[model samples]
Target chain A: MTLALYVPRQSAVHRVPAGGKLLALAVLAVVLFAVPTLPVAAAGLLGVLLVGLGAARLPAASLARQARTVRWWLAGLFVFHALFSDLPTAAVTVLRLLALVLAAAVVTATTRVTEMVAVIEWLCAPLRVFGVRPARIGLVIAMALRFIPVLAERADRIREAQAARGGSARGLRGVRTTVTPLLVQLLQMAHTISEALDARGADDEPPARGRRSPVTAA
Target chain B: MKTKDLAYIALFAAIIAVLGTLPAVNIGPVPITAQTLGVMLAGGVLGARRGFLAVLLFLVLVAIGLPLLSSGAGGLAVFAGATAGYLYSWPVAAFVIGWLTERVWSRYTVVWGVLINVLGGMVVIYLIGVPVLAAVANLSLWEAIVSGAWPFLPGDAAKAFIAAAIADQVRRSYPVIERPQRELAGR
Candidate 1:
């Protein structure tokens, strides 16, 4: 079975504040890219992998699974450098990429979506002075997070339908065949949802703006 | 904005994320994914402001460490990568598409939608994505163009056609734009 990015567990990594974790990730990246040595990057990759699997208590295989997706790109980078530059440079570059990817995975696996949303809302509070509403923006993000899994399930069903009809195409044609119908269904769903929202007066702006207070009107 | 508008933005953002999950067709370093079609639809149907907001919301989520990007990658590191230009181009791309769609409302034909998607969604994004990718990947400009833009042209054309058709069908079936207040009051 394909491993999920997040594994729900009680661990220190999970307990760390989202902001702190994000900060650590940024610092790690700065160090890795600033010092582009093979040994340095290799060390960083080893430390990140170890922390993900050990400190975070993530399953070793699951952590490795994240690396599996980028193996091809790493291989390509290796070949590119090998042909143009040198093997040492190629090794350092791939390691650098892998370290960054693993570090990101660690953050995602540990942090909850809600926590991140909270941090985002807090950060965006300053925009209120500019007449921006952070709460509404936060709601949009929360809703998007909630619907991602639902839509992914819908896509699977669409692909299944295509396969049943023996109409599945490969490569770019496959994207066209799958995406067209998927967009239609999603847009239709959005239509229904918008109607529900409007019926509940979700689109209405309060008429209180620009109105005088009771004392002023008197 | 109304709750309906917020819902639309959130729904489109989710659509972008869901599109990312589909396996990418590897053309070169930058694989072709279905997410850009979502970007096109967001602009074509939602109008400019909401479309831009929807994409902005997606990008923010990507920045804050959501594994919503193609290939299950996310966080600030992505902003420093070869694809960084493409990542950063999404909002402007959506805005342009929506702006074009709104101005040409009288003639909101499939042709118009296709043109907007190509010019705004594909071309604008590539103009930014190619150079940034070249700089980060250390490739020459011509090599970057060959590797990044050339193979995707035909697929993007197909995407543009289908995105326009889908948007046209959506507009006909369900009116997304707000009606005049008098018309609403009469109803």
Candidate 2:
């Protein structure tokens, strides 16, 4: 349920402003994907690894853990390209993907969720001029981030409960059975949350523009 | 927006992200993921606007480098990759699904739910994803079709069915579909 990639540490990567890190990540991604060649990808990979390990002070395992999920994809990508195209193209593609993932890992590991939310809110503040409530938007995003782990845990519980009932979520039927109960519970949870928010007057719109009606003023 | 609407938006976005954490079903280039099911549910249960907002929120986070996508990949870099078209189609997919659901709410049935999900979630998404993938990866359209759409048809059908079943059942029980007060008053 936890954000497995994030490990709190005091280092230069962690100290960098979230906006700056995000900007750097964007630039890094553009450069890697734009001119993707084997040597260029290799250089990008090395650069990301150096920043991840040295600047972020993240353990090698953290990087490995993030890469672990994509290990099969990398292999599959290579095979697909080798058969369809050539080894160099495959290698370059894999390297580019790895470099991007590693760079992302560094950013996520260093930046706290709250800091990320704040940065998002700050970035979206300009939309307030168009009657968009950046604060509300930010809060919704923050809430979503916070609930991800909780719901994931809930899913685990649902699966375990199904297992206890001698049900294995194996094939198509199993998926239906497992998903039905999970969605029911999730919807129920949503209803309860909305009710609680309503009880707290969350739906109450503020007084409109602080303007008195002409009739009332007269 | 009401707090309840905000709550729904946030919860559905979280649900999508949670689904992303599930182990991806590795296909050749694009992986089969539960996140699309989350997208369907967001639309079917939350109605169109909220569903769109929820997905947009998730995408914004992903754009900011959140590793919330399947296989822990995120950031603007992904926008340049082969799967970017699929990623970009999600919000529109959710919106279409939700909009259809909202329009058919009074006469909703499981059949309609399945149809809507398939139409919006699978067909709509594939419409956008295949060509973009071909362009990005420099493959022929036929090759892109082979890689992007053909392999996942059965699984996606099942996902659409399940998403519809759950959404329909939830609607039957909770009835969270938003109706404007003026519409209700007119009725």
Model 2 alpha-carbon drift over 4 Å, by segment: A4-9, A34-46, A58-102, A160-167, A171-177, A190-218, B23-29, B138-147, B179-187
Clashing pairs in 1: A202-B3, A203-B2
Q: Pick by DockQ: which candidate is best?
A: 2
lDDT of 2 by residue, A1-218 (tens): 34534689989889999889989988877787679788999999999999999877899998897787568867876787888889999898788778887887788788887777788889888997998776677667777776776887787887788789896777656645666656667667766776886797656654466487888778
Estimate the TM-score of every prediction.
0.74, 0.79
Candidate 2 residue pairs in clash (backbone atoms < 3 Å): none
Q: Lowest-scoring 10 consecutive residues by lDDT in candidate 2 chain B?
A: B65-74
Candidate lDDT values, in order: 0.77, 0.82
What are the TM values for chain B, all candidates? Answer: 0.92, 0.95
**lDDT digits (tens) for residues A19-60 of candidate 1:** 998878777776776688998999999999878888889887
